[model samples]
Target: MMTFYNKQTTEQKEFYENLLSSLASLSKLFSSSDTPYLHYRAHEILFCYAFGANNISRGDVSFDATKDGVGIGLKTFLHGNGNTFQKIAEFNSVSDEIRELGSNHNDIAHFIADKRNERLTDTLSITSTKEMLYHVITRNNQSLNIAECRMSFVEKARIKKVTLKKNNIYFKDSLHEYNFSLAKNTLYKKFDISENILHSIDVNIMGNPFQLLENLSVFDTKESTKTMEIILPLYSTSTGDVGRSSGLNQWNASGRERHQDEVYIPIPSWIHNQFPDFFNYKGKTTPSFMVKLPNTDLVPFKVCQSGGKALMSNPNRLLGHWLLRDVLKLQAGQLATRQLLRQKDIDSVLVTKVEGKEYDYELDFLKYGSYEKFEESHKE
Candidate 1:
């Protein structure tokens, strides 16, 4: 087992201290006063922290003329050269690579659509960042490392043109609009123009420019061919009074109206590709992630310690564990959480409405003999 050490070489010490300082700096930026430039402020600050600590490697934390600079292009930054920052994606208690972006070893480059939607902008707030830091820093050998996470939101866009410029595919949503009706808008979207998270557009870390695609799929064009897939029936009004209805006479009876601003998640195809298991043979089986439906459950410190990115990534995985531990009251060392699927249950959920911008989500579950029953059924 690796024990904590108080001593280290000058370079090692610099790397460690740089991260410590970066954390402090980021914390201050997040907790400080609000501003229209909050997005820009946090973005640059995160870049500063990531770039500074990234250079601490190879004995070069001091800003030099070479790879040690954080101001490198986005293309270069993704290439992982002078600096490293944690990429955020929902994950389990352990670390997993959801996707790969340009490594910063080269030049840094990033891209923003002339009209990128903004529903998941508030992700910059410390609520999500804190979880990311806890796992990326505190969990792994307690050492600071490079990482990042995917942000999400809703966007209602009309097809303009499918253009492929600069190796980045951009499906521009002309006149893109977002809903800031309730405070919920603050939960995810935050493009204050007055406050933007984007540090610089067309940022590439190593010449690996961000690929801009016109649509989710090249085949999905202005004429459109694909159908909207509901990953999880958003938790909206119930299926009764304002629930999802089904009837012939009520053909239009599906009264539920999607926010004119369709929900959109900004995870790149690379990162989005990580959750294949969630969709694999999906129509056949749905992952019934277990949640400890305590009337007023806390954010279980164990789960929070893993960080929100981790919490979001494999929600089903951790939810399974919570069932085994909290609900089943399993012993600490007895066993790890078991992955289970609720074929019927998941199928039913397919029609449920999701509660957008939930602090914590609630889902249907089996009351008694659930974990054991699932375990025994899969014994084969």
Candidate 2:
């Protein structure tokens, strides 16, 4: 936690505090903002450390750097931004090597940031200078502050190339024309910019880089992949007209009048690779996939894969029949609340949408589960 302060007299301190208060109040005017440039740079620096690479440099290889000739590409993500780290297929030069590395590290130099008070809360007001704090989380759910950095914006420019550049770390969006850059890092943007700052960072990271990468290898191994359980929460819509199609198509189709809230969840290839049986396997013999909601018995669920993602499809009345009506106890003309997905022994609580908002759900890779025994027990 970084505090805002400086060496100043009483009058100077009062003036500074007043200025900060005014800026905080005025930040509510803007309607939208892009991902902080600090996030991209922090990701790059973390990647360099996670994969045993030191001193960043430009390259045609898949990785940003190397360790003993092994090319190491770094992929990073924020805690709440969701967990689908992607390496654009077109940008990867050494495809095999990249895939090999991704498979080796579960396909990422995965890192997550902790939620902080100074983070941008209002989408309208954009003026902020708080340094981001991050914690590197392992597959075993161990969290340690391995990397923390402060950012400064450099410049913004148009992103002409679709493929990745050597030093280009962040691109705002594929849909946007102009992007922002910080020194070598590049991030694209869809929305129009009005004098947004170009972001840069000063980094402080942990441990011997190689040792951290080596410690993470246990998760990347083939043995770590197994049939595991995952809780997929499905949220209901907030409000609508009497006959309006509440996006809850699954529920409405089953003679229920509930609206659905759509959430885009990233299904990383690593998850598919690890839980191939639950995600990739298609057969009738698979166990009764029951979703344990709050105060409800396990309701039936069907897991399916599309692209590199997995979704719990409720084809029948599994959700509407029991969980929606009984557990949630939702009714017409009322605000539909969110549900939870939990496993047998894990302490983590995963929701369809955090804060009950319409944002994408951040899939935690450390949390996965199996239903073989549960299915057997219910077979009678």
Which stretches in model 2 have alpha-carbon errors above 4 Å? 2-132, 135-147, 150-179, 182-185, 188-254, 259-301, 304-310, 313-380
Candidate 1 regions with alpha-carbon error over 4 angstroms: 1-154, 164-169, 174-296, 299-378
Give residue 287's error in model 2 in angstroms.
3.5
RMSD of each: 22.8, 19.9
Question: Estimated TM-score per prediction?
Answer: 0.19, 0.23
lDDT, candidate 1, 1-380, per-residue tens: 11112222456545544544434333323333211112323333344344332211111011111122111211111221322332211111111111132332111111121112210121112011211111112111112222222223222334334343333222323332222111111111212221212122221121211232223354534542322111222112122111122110111233565221111111112212443432232223233232222222223211121111112213323333443343333343332112111211111111112122222233233212232343344323
Give the Cα-based TM-score of candidate 1 against the true structure.
0.19
Write the residue-wise lDDT of candidate 2 on 23-124 in tens digits: 222222321222211233444554444333332222111223333323223333333322223321121212333345332221221100000111111100
The local distance difference test score of model 2 is 0.29
Compare the candidates by TM-score and give the number of the best one.
Answer: 2
